[model samples]
Target: MRLELEKRPERSKIMAVVSPIAAVVATLLTGAVIFAAIGIPPLKGLWVFFLEPFSSLWSIEELVVKATPLILIGIGLSIAYRANVWNIGAEGQLTAGALAGSLVPIFANSWQSPLTLVAMLALGVLGGMLWGLIPALLKIKSGANEILVSLMLVYVAQLLLDWLVRGPWRDPHGYNFPKSVSFDGWQTMPTIGDGRLNWGILFALVAAVALAVLLRRTMKGFEIRVLGEAPRAGRFAGFSSDRMVVFAFLVSGGLAGLAGVIELTSTVGQLQPNISPGYGFTAIIVAFLGRLDPIGVIVAALMLAVSYLGGEAAQVALGLSDKAARVFQGVLLFWVLACDTLILYRLRFVPGLPAGETAR
Candidate 1:
């Protein structure tokens, strides 16, 4: 009898370039299979989900709207991940930022303009930073696991938003709905071409440009790379791990907060229980899919946005359930993880099994 064990493949220099594309293609193929299983034609489903969004103005607008927050959150995550700081609580930070930014609008009910927007954004950044600082502090002082702390905060923030909207911040006028009072003209987000599309798109584009420069052209960026690629080297060079952790989390949290600010002012125009469709969680996928590059995130975000639109199309055209779209998103994420694994490790066969090997 012979025993077999798979060996990891050698690292390929070309895998870096091919991994993301492979992930995308694999996701598409998997989605097609799902469509076939659901009694729908794969070609028609692909056309509706991928092509139809770009064929019309309204659908394209929706794509931009969906992609905006995703890009913003992805940029922050790219920076954090590159610095070796794992922050999984971006969703919580987002919720806190939205709630903090909306306080002025809810209470004042009189002041509104460019200034209000600026204050709201500033508060959002502060709130998110503070939220991120919690785990950072714990990790620094007590050697706590940042991943657990950050992820747990997401549920806390979600509960807080629900409490505020349903109890204290509920709209006092009209009917008893779990929503905040809507902001007037100046308080609302500015649109593109008289449509629901907001200046958040501009903000997203600006952030992408800035992060691209920050990651590629700055001294601080080099430090982050050093910390991530070789932590021991960073320590040998006298870099402070504690400081880096705090800095990375704060910056990431602040960006997520900025995303929340844009989302509230531009889309919902008021506080709601569900501010996002889990953009914060999904941005993690975007960061990895983009290979932790800011410019690549822009493209990845757009692809994800296309999937969102396609899911809607499937719902309407093929009478599929909302869960069907979720399945596609999950498939995309799975394929991305699998492709990244292949990029990092290849499989090989050995002539014979070594000692300690057992086979059926």
Candidate 2:
């Protein structure tokens, strides 16, 4: 006998919506097992990691602070994904943006001004867009694979930042440290309170709303969606593939660059060797976990931010290695992908007494 089931198209869409939630639950359950294996009380460990971060106003503020960059990058990635463009170089673009934005402050050697702030922000956007354009141009002109080119550029961007901070952009009075000079209050983003939270949260929220509207309520968005789902259909409707690629990459890279600027201005208050901590890469997970929807990305970004706070707490309270937290993050991504696959495919079983005599 063989076991088989008919495929359901509508069921797949419904599962896609629930896959992320299932992944979260699976991660928690799997984590509990790990905690027990590590000689910690599973319940207490889970509570400390997941609940402790929200038990105070301060921690809540920190969550917002960390989530801001993720949201910005996730939103940008959602747009690119919707247009069927893959921009894996957001990390590099982000670094380039921060590097370009910091140029004014590093060279000026004076108090911050409105002009400086605007110029830096604009330059940051330009830096990211230019970096994004490299892959787009290659893909269009030479049939190059953007996924490979974009990802390869990330290392280049990191190296560029390392060289600048360790060389020309290094602070003069910081005793040979590899970091940039600090920004003045005017150059830095204004804080919401005495906490780490800043105006970057508002920027992320606004961008999310704007993208949601643009994608759901505009003809341009329709073109993007069509192009993503069916390139032939889009071409028939007069949409240019090259234009979509450039537009998607520019928007995604520009937003990632803006996120880099915000992180520098609001959180770190200056350029550093590792300002991002992989926020650009994390945003890719955020975009997928949120189902590539604008509103979904916001929620997923917040959830991922909580995971970061949870990691810190686990490190401090549980005496766990910092790398332990990364394991949880990796598990989340793995299970999430697995859930998505299950949603699209199913398992089947067969039983037989013999290969030559297969009759029931």
- Tens digit of lDDT per residue, candidate 2, span 1-360? 665444556448778878999999999999899999999999998998888989999999999999998998999999999899999889988988888788778887585677777787788888888888999999999989999999999999999999989998888987899888888866788888888888889989999999999999999899989999999999999999999999999989998888888888888888778988788988998898888888999999988898889989998999987677678878888888888875766646667554456664
Where model 2 places Cα greater than 4 Å from the true spot, the runs are 1-6, 11-13, 342-360
Task: List lDDT for all candidates, in order.
Answer: 0.86, 0.87
Residue 24 accuracy (lDDT) in model 1: 86
Clash count per candidate: 2, 0
Q: Tens digit of lDDT per residue, candidate 1, span 7-74?
A: 35665668777888898888888878878987889988888888898998888899999999889889
Please give the TM-score that candidate 2 achieves against the real structure: 0.92
Report the number of the highest-lDDT candidate. Answer: 2
Error (Å) of candidate 1 at residue 300 is 0.6
TM-score versus the correct structure, for each prediction: 0.93, 0.92
